[model samples]
Target: MRTEFNWHLTAWKSLGRPSPGDIIWETELLNHSELVMRKRAYQNSTLYATFPRDPCDSYVHCGGNGNSVLNSSLICQCLKRFVPGSLENWNLKDFLKGCVRRKPFSCRNDGFAKYLQLKLLDTTHNWINKSKNLVECMAKCLSNCSCSAYTDIDVRGRGSSSAIWFE
Candidate 1:
């Protein structure tokens, strides 16, 4: 069943639009179980809906860890929505490369604290829920000259949050 589903997903992905059968099957799958319905949330929130081309092959293999699937899907959706043009044209690999790049700096007062509020304004308006804690952490990072970038450590659960500092 998983292989068949994957084949259909890949075919639909290649076509750039869901076929009637795909739609029917998807609707049936979503209607059959709550878990499937929850999975559909990831599909509905996808930014690839607007794209007219196939995403990178990696897209199909998303949600490796059960805990991070939802967040991973959300991130993938954001990538598809914010970056203009087809996935083929977008330099997703490079974008992530830049994010992970480390620059020399001093973390004079660097330390990890729990429940630190941070805010990440989804410029693309992709992530529906605004994370105040994420926003504040981002603000803190921006205010500090030594901070390179901030990312969440825990993406699961309602109040999950964490940040990474580069020096």
Candidate 2:
């Protein structure tokens, strides 16, 4: 026997996703009563998930260790050499807690790894250099004993931009 469980859109929205999320509405939805949608109607069945779009677009949606790469098979994977911070939660598909490094950073022994097209992490605690090229960025980041990561950017939102992070 198949058990039916119903989840209301309002209940999901109450969790802080203020918008309707990334859903594609059927053409017929145009004819549906606006009150049904405005009233938190999941019963319309005229909407469906648009997987090309995503719901985890906020900063650090997958916590600190998991990166939210749009269109990837796994939006929340454990970082290299790391493990989920809570395997139980991961198994339960609750990826919010993200992952954790298996080994802590050892300043003198650590090295940087680079990937293409990855966005910068949280910036409230980082320093930005709008004119530094990639080579110069690395030299400066490596020269700093506390630097953990560096990336190309123009935090000023103009001109050249690069950044280094503190572990």
Best by TM-score: 2
TM-score of each: 0.22, 0.58
**Full-model lDDT for every candidate:** 0.34, 0.62
Tens digits of lDDT, candidate 2, 1-167: 11243323432343566656434332222221121223324565443332223445454667776777658766676667668888898777678777877888776777776665555676645788877877888889888888878887764555367888876
Cα TM-score of candidate 1: 0.22
Off by over 4 Å in 2: 1-53, 69-74, 154-159
In candidate 2, clashing pairs total: 3
| Predicted candidate 1 versus true structure: per-residue lDDT over 31-99, tens digit per residue | 111111112343463222322133332223222110112334333322211232234422352223112
Clashing pairs in 2: 130-160, 153-161, 154-161
Model 1: lowest-lDDT 10 consecutive positions: 30-39
